[model samples]
Each structure stands twice: as C-alpha cells, then as structure tokens.
Target: MDINRMQDKIIAEFENLATAVNKFSYFRHLKKISNGSQPMDPEDKNDRNLVTGCSRKVWVTAYKEDGRIFFKADSEHSITRGLVNLLLKVYSGHTVSTITNTDLYFLHEIKLFNYLSASWMRDFLSVIQRIKSLAIVQHLDAAPRS
Candidate 1:
C-alpha cells in the first residue's frame, strides 16, 4: 500500500475513536502489536542503530530487499514505540526515493501533536530523522561503484 493510503487508514481509525483517551489507548494497542510482530534483535539494539536526541531509548534498523527499504524499531517507551510503528507502517517496504520524498502529513491529520509533550515530540522527530538517514545509507550502499 502507498504512504497516503496507509495514512488515510490511520486517520480513519482515529476518527472512529471519540476521545483523547481512546486515541492513547489505540497507540498502546499498536505498540503491543508491534512488540509481538517485530521484535528487535538484541544485537541490533546497539549504538549504531540507536536513535539520538530522543528522551527515550529508541533503536531503528534498516535494510534493503528487492530494492525496497524495510525498518525494524524498538523503544523503551510504549507511546514512542507506537509512534514509530505508525511511521514504519507507512514507510517500510518502500523504495529509497519514495521514502525520502514522502512528507508525513498523517501527524497533523491525526492531531498527534496535541497529545505529545515537547520532549516526546522532539523524540518523535528524531525517530523520523533516523529512519530517513538509514534509508539514505541503504541507498548509498546500493549504488554502483563507478
């Protein structure tokens, strides 16, 4: 699925929930699901994969398969994990160009900024930067050595 469609699906899911508390519950639910389905390897939780500038410890790892970038991330904080999972849902399995070019408008559409504290929002932005940087590294590594 494309990024916009995935984002729209998330927005729709949020639209069903009537309250801020329910929205937070939804994030926890996403975190639980991500924990079960995408456990980060212990080796991958090292310094190289660790995302800096975040209040929490978040690790993001990326690799390319069949010319598409895939990411696996884990965070010490549940809400942070859920937020990153949301990003992964949209960005993973996309080409480097697609991932780099796409703008994540879902954050505003879902009104996520209202729920986040300044530190958490900063952490979220850091996670996004980490994902993009990893995608760029994958792209450079895949380039032909002319």
Candidate 2:
C-alpha cells in the first residue's frame, strides 16, 4: 500500500483500539507481521543502531534495494519493539524520497505523543531521524556523481 493509505490505516487502527492493553496487543501484532521469526541479534545491538535517550535499548537498521528502503529493528522491551515494528511497517518498502518526504503526523493523531515522557519523546524522534538519515545517505550514494 502507498504511504497515504498506510498512514490512514495506522491512524484508524490506533484510534479504533481502546485501552493501553489493546494498543500494546495491536503493536505486537504489527511486530509479528514485520519481524516474522528472525529478529535482531545480540551482536548487532551496539552503539551504531542503538537508539539513545530511551529507557531501554532500541536498535534500528535500514538499507535500500532497487530504490526501495527496508528496515529491521529490535528493542529490549515489548512496547518499544511494537513501536519500532509499527514504524517499519509504514516506512519499509518505500523509496527514499517517499520515506524522507513523509510526515508522521499520525503519531499525534493516535495520541501516542501525549503519553510519552521527555526522554521517550527524544528517543522517538531519534528513531525517526535515524530512518530519514539512512534514506538521505542511501539517496546520496545512489545519485550520479557529477
């Protein structure tokens, strides 16, 4: 699905779900869809992909293939894992331009930002920035050297 459709679907899913329990359950569902069987390894969990400022360790990795982006992530906690999974669901398989230009306004519409602490918010933004930076680097690398 396109980014717009995915955004709307995510907003609707979160808005439709009631209670933190349900929300977390839905996030796990998304994680299952994204992560499948193999998850990030212990060795890969280092300073490179680790999301700083989070209460728990979170690692996110991104790559590009045939102009489309892919992401893999894992977190020390279930809730954060779910969050990363949700983001990857929306972000992965898109072009660098699409990923970079997209706005994550649905996060606010889902009321997730409201419940986040200052540190969590910083970590959340860091995840987003990491994703965009990866896209930027990939785009630049793919560009023809003039």
What C-alpha lDDT do the candidate models reach, one value each? 0.85, 0.75
Winning candidate number (TM-score): 1
Instruction: Give a tens-digit lDDT track for model 2, residues 27-133.
Output: 55545544442487777788988876667788877777998888888887766677777778788889998998898877877777766668767877778888888
**On residues 11-50, what C-alpha lDDT tens digit does candidate 1 reach at each position?**
8877776665565576666566457548889989898888
Measured against the true structure, the TM-scores of the candidates, in listed sequence, are 0.90, 0.79
Clashes of 2: 0
Number of colliding residue pairs in each model: 0, 0
The residue-level lDDT of candidate 1 at 59 comes to 96
Most accurate candidate by lDDT: 1
Question: Which segments of model 1 are wrong by more than 4 Å?
Answer: 19-37
What residue pairs clash in candidate 1, if any at all? none
lDDT value, candidate 2, whole model: 0.75
